[model samples]
Target chain A: MEQHMSEIVTAAFIVIGDEILSGRTKDKNIGHIADILTSVGVDLKEVRIVSDDEDAIIDAVNALRARYTYVFTSGGIGPTHDDITADSISKAFDLPCEHDVAAIELLRDYYKGRDIEFNEARQRMARMPKGATHIANPISIAPGFRIGNVHVMAGVPSIFRAMLDNVLPTLETGAKLISTTTPCPFGEGIISTPLGQIQKDNPEAIIGSYPKLAESGNFMTDIVVRARSEEVLERTTGAVRALVARLLTEQDTGQ
Target chain B: MEQHMSEIVTAAFIVIGDEILSGRTKDKNIGHIADILTSVGVDLKEVRIVSDDEDAIIDAVNALRARYTYVFTSGGIGPTHDDITADSISKAFDLPCEHDVAAIELLRDYYKGRDIEFNEARQRMARMPKGATHIANPISIAPGFRIGNVHVMAGVPSIFRAMLDNVLPTLETGAKLISTTTPCPFGEGIISTPLGQIQKDNPEAIIGSYPKLAESGNFMTDIVVRARSEEVLERTTGAVRALVARLLTEQDTGQ
Candidate 1:
C-alpha cells in the first residue's frame, strides 16, 4: 500500500433517514465511521444528518463532495418507498441511474441459497447510478455503491459498518498518527495563552485543548497534541511539558 | 410539565469546531443529543457540523434556529483562541455579550476548592450573552448558556451530555414514545407498496423501513413503526405484522 505524505486526508459523512430526523432511531454510523477513519489516518471532518428529503440530500452531497476528499453517505438505499438515495445522487451528479445488471446478479446469487424470494422488492436493491462501482456487502447481498467521491452504504449499523471496512482500505491513506494528552486541573483560560504560544512555536504539530468537566464536580482540561511524525510531535510535547510545569508553579504560589 | 399537542417539535444541532473539520476529532455529541431528544419527544430534524469559522457559525445559527423550534450547539466554548461560541451566538442574536456576574460567581466558588489559579484564562468561561440563562454543568464550572431557543453546551462528550440532561426536563415535552419493528426477509422494494398502504391506513403513526443485510449473506429488512400514543403504535404494528406475513406468502407461492 502506498502512503500519502504528511498532508491531511479529509472526509465528510452524510446520514439520511426520516427515522433519524424524527429522533425515532439513534444514528450509530457517525461514530463507527469516525473511529475507522481515525485508525486509517483519514480525517473524518464534518457530518450532516438530514432527512430523506431530496433537496437536502442533493445540496449536502454537492457541497461536501466539493469540499472534502471523500464523502460517505449511509441510509436511504433500501427497497422501501422512501429509499431515494439512488435517484438523489444521480440528480446531484447529473447522471442517469437505473437497475444495474451486476447488482441484480449479486442479489440473485445470494437469494438462490436462501429461503427468500428474488422478487421486485428484492430487485430494488440492485439499482445503481450510471458508471458506479458496487461496494461488497459480506453480511448482505444488497451491495453498497460508490459513485465519484461518494460511498453510499446501508443504514443498518451492522451492514453499514461491514461495508465501510471493505471500502476504507481502498482509499488513499496518510501517515500513522501519534498523540499525547496532559491533564491540567486549572480551567481552560489559564492554559489558552500558553497553548497559543506553543502552537506558534511548533507549527508542525497539531495541538488541541479540550475542557472537560469531571464526574467529581471539578473542572479539568485535557491538552491533546497530535502529529504525523514522531520527532516533531516529541519536540512539541517537550515544549508543552515545560510550559505546563511553569504554569503549574505560577498558579500554585499566587504569583 | 405542560404537554403540547403540536404535530411535531423539531430541533437542529450545530456543532462548531476546527478539530471536527480537520478530522482530528470524531464528534460524539450529535449521537448523544439525538438519543436524549428522542426519549424526550423532540424531533432532532437536522444536524450541521461546521468549522469553527465565525461566518459559518453565524450563518448556520441563523438558518437552523429560525427553521427549527430549538437549536443546540456544542464546542467552541473553551479558553483557547478557538473558543468563540459565546461571541458568535452574540453576533447571531445581535446581543451584547460580556462576562456574567452569576457565571463569575459560579467560577469563583468552583475554583476556590481547587489548588489552581482563577486567572484571566479561567475567567473566559464566565462570559455569556446578554439575557442568556446559564445551563448547569455538573461536570465542570464553565457553564453552558441558553440564549432564546439555542442551547449552547460544551463540546466534550461528558460535559455536553451532563448539560443536556440538566436542560431536558425543563423543556415542554410533547408525548412519551411507543415503537415496534417487524422483520421481513424480502428486500425493501417488495415491502414498499404494502408499507405505503400501512402508513396511509395509520396516518397518526410514523412507519419506516430499514434495510439490513443479514449476517448469513441474505437481505432482510426491518419495518419499524412508531407513534406518540401507545394505542396507535400497537395498531400500526399489528397492521405491519399482518402485511409482512401476507407478503411473504405471496412471494413464496409466486403469486
Candidate 2:
C-alpha cells in the first residue's frame, strides 16, 4: 500500500431535483458518483438532495462548495423551465450566467441532424455561469461547467457519469482508503464492549458495525475496518479478526 | 384541496452509516421517509448522508435542525460500538444519554425468554438524550427518541418505518400537496420556451420536468405541477395539459 497521505481530499454532492424530493424518482446518480469518487481516492463526506427551487439550490451549492475540496452536483442542468441549476449556481457565486460559444457550438453540431431542434429551450443548456470552465458531457451535447470548487452536471445518470469521467482526471488525488469486512453471525449486543475497546486502540482507523435482522429474528452484524494507513489498517483488522474469532470459539464450546 | 394560508412544514433527513458512504449499501430509508413526509403535509426539504464520524453527525444535525422545522435521523441506534448515533445526537443537544426505564422495561419484557439475551449491548438501545420522549418501535422493543425537533430512529428499514408510524401521528400536519404529472411526448427542448411562460403564469405552483431517455434514443419528459391549494393545482395542471395538447396536435399535423 502507498504511504498515508498528508491530506484527504473531500467532496460533497448536491443532488438537485424536484422529482427526487417528491419521491417520484429514486436517485441513481449519488451511488454512481460515490463509487467513482471513492475509487479515485476522494472522500465523499456529505451528500444533500434538494428540490429544483432556485433558493434551495443556491444555498446548498454555496454551503457545500465552501466546505469540501470539490462539490459535485447532479441534475437540473437540462433544457427545461424547471432546470434552473446553472442559474442558481451563478446566483450562489454572485455571477451572471450567459450563453457560451463553445457549448452553443457543440449543441448546434449535435442537433443539426437530430429530431430535437436547437431552439431556445435546447439553447438554454448552453447557458453557464460567467467565468466558469466547461465540463465535457459526451452522453449529452450540453456541457456541464466548473466554477470554483463546484462541478455542475446533468441529472441523468449517463450524462453525470460522462461529466465525472471528464472532471475526475483533472482533480488532485489523495491516499486511497483501505478496508476489510468480516461477517459476524452474532448479535451486536455481544460485541459492543470489546468493539469499543478496539475502536479506542485504533484511533486512526474507522470501525463500523452494521446490524441486519435475520429470518430467525437475530441480529447479524458486518464489521468493516477502514483506514488510510496500511499498518493501521492491518493492525486494526487483525485485532477485529481475533476478537470475532475468540467470541466464536467461546460460543462453540459453551452454547 | 383546502386553502393554503398556513405555514409549510419542512424536514431534513440525516442518514448515518458507513455503508452508504462506501457505496456498499444502497439507501432505502430516504425515499421511504420522503414519501411518508410528503403524504403527511410536510415538505422534505433536504437529505444528508454522513458516515459514522462523530463530528460529521453533529454538524449535520445542528445545521439541518436549525434550518428546517424537523430533522429526522436514521441509523446508529443499535447495540454495537459503531452504533454511536444516539450518543452523537445527545452531544448535539449538549445532553447526557441514559437508558430510559420505559425502554428497558419494554426490552426486558420482549427478551425475557427469547434466544437473544437482554444484555448490556441490548441495553444500549435504551439510551436517549436528557429531556427526550421515546418514539415507540413496534417491530423491535427498543424505542427511538425525540430531542427538540430532531427525531432519532433506527437505520433498518422495517424498524424505521415502524418508528415513523408512531411519530407521524404526533406531528402537526400541514396542507397536503396536490400534484398532476403530464406525460409530454415532445422533447424538453420543444416545450422549454412555452413552459417558462406557463411557469410564470402559475407562480403559486412548482413546475418540474423530468426527462427520460429511451432505448430508441428519444427524450420523454414528465412534467409535474404541484401546489398546496386545489384551485391553484387545477389551474396550473389545466394550462400544462392544454400546452401539451397543442404541441402534440402541431406534431400530428406536421405544422
Candidate 3:
C-alpha cells in the first residue's frame, strides 16, 4: 500500500550503536542494506547513524518513519542493558512496550535444550511494542519487530541480512532501475560542463559523475546514468558516450 | 570557544553522494572520519549519508550544525554536475557563495604546467560560502572551506583525509576518553544481567556490549567501558571482568 503507481520507492536507514560512534566497530551493515535495497528496486534516500541513546533513537525513528516509505534500523535490540532500540521504537510510536507472547514462547522453546539459561535478561529480547509484527531472525531466535513503517533488526551483519531477506519479499518495490557507467580518462574538470548539459537535457535519467584516482594518481571520471525506462537509459548513455568520444577526439587532434 | 570548560566536544558528519547510496560505492569516509574524530577527542555523535541533492545537503548541514559543536561534510565538492555540496552549504547558512581568491590563485598555479585546462568547471572548485576560510588540500590544489563550525571536504578518501588533517588541529577538542575491553566467553544472554548491574554502578562510564560471530557461528560478546577519567575506566572494566569471571565459575559448577 505504501507504493502507488509511481516507479519510486524510498527508504531511510538508521544505525543505532555506541560502538560505531565511539570508533570501536566499523559498520558493515550500511553497505549491505544499501545493496539489498537497491537489488529490490528500493531507493535508499538517507542513512543516519546515531548512538545507543534512547532519546536519539526515538527522535530518529519518528522523524524517518514519517518521511520515507520504510525506515530500517539495525543494532540495540540485544539483551544487554545498552540495548534500548525496541523500547525506543515503542516510545516513538506511543505504544505500550511489553513482552510479546509469541516471542517469549519462541525464545523459551529455543533455549530449552541449550546450555544457556532462559533468564530475565534473555526474556528482555522478547519485548516489543503492542501491535508489532515479528520479522523473523533465522540466525538468532530473538526476532526483530516491524511496527508501523519502521523495521528493527539485529546489529550482527549475518542476522541483519537474514532479517532483511525475510522482510524484502513483503515490501512494495518500484520498477528496477536500468543503469550504465561510462569511464572517461579525462578529469571531471574537462567533462563537467557538457555532462551538466547532458543531465539538464535528460531530466528523466539520474546522471552522476564520480572521480577516481588512478594508480598513477591521475584523475579519471566515471559517468553513471540511471533511469526506470530502458529507452531513456540507453538514450542518456548514448549522449554521454558521444560527448566522451568528442572530447577524446579533441584531445588527440590538439583542438 | 565551543568547548568552554566542558570535556565533551561533539561533532556530526554528513556524507554527500549518490554513488554511496546507490551501492556503486561503499563509503570509506565515515569510518575514517569517525576514527579521526575519536583520536582528536571529539565525540562523533551522529552521521548522515545523503545523496548529492541540494535540499538533502542543505537540510543535513543545517540540522547537524545546530546540534553539534562541529559539522564535517565530505563529497560533492568536485568539478562535476553532481557536485553541489558547496552551494548547498552556502544556502544552508544563507551566505552568498562566491569564488575564493586564494583558491582560484592556487588552482590556477597548480594547473599552470599541467595538461588539464583551468576551465570554468575547474574554477567551480574555488567557490565557497562568503567569509569561509580554506581547509587546505595538499594532494589537490582545490581547497575545502570552513564556514563557522562546518568544514566541507572532498569525497575522495585520500583528499578527505588530507583536508581533515589540516582542519583537526584548528578545532576545539575534549578530554580524551580512556577505554578498556574484556572478551567474554559467555553469550550476551548469560552476561547481560550482571553487565547491567555493572553499568548501573558506574554511572559516569559508557558501557557497551558488542556481539561478534565466531568462525563456528557462535556469539561472542566484548564488554567495553569508556570514561574521561582513567580511574573510572579502570574501575568499571575491573567490575566487568569480575562479572565475567563469576559467570564462568557458575557455568563450570552447573549451579
Highest DockQ: which candidate? 3
Question: What are the clashing pairs of model 3?
Answer: none
Please give the CA lDDT of all the candidate structures: 0.81, 0.85, 0.89
User: Across residues A8-100, which tens digit of lDDT does each residue of candidate 3 receive?
Assistant: 889999999988987889999999988888877899999999999899999888888999989999999999899999899999999999999
Pull out the clashing pairs in model 1.
A79-B188, A79-B189, A121-B189, A121-B190, A189-B121, A189-B122, A213-B139
Ranking by lDDT: 3, 2, 1
Task: Please give the fraction of native interface contacts (Cα pairs under 8 Å between A and B) kept by each candidate.
Answer: 0.65, 0.73, 0.81
Off by over 4 Å in 3: A1-5, A252-255, B1-6, B252-255
> Per-residue alpha-carbon lDDT of model 1 for A5-45, expressed as tens digits?
76778889999997876555677777678777877888776
Report the poorest 10 consecutive residues by lDDT, candidate 2 chain A.
A246-255
Chain A only: TM-score of every candidate?
Answer: 0.93, 0.95, 0.96
Q: What is the number of backbone collisions in each predicted candidate, taken in the order shown? A: 7, 1, 0
Say which prediction, candidate 1 or candidate 2, comes out ahead on DockQ.
2
Per-residue lDDT, model 3, residue B98, is 96
Q: Of models 1 and 2, which has the larger lDDT?
A: 2
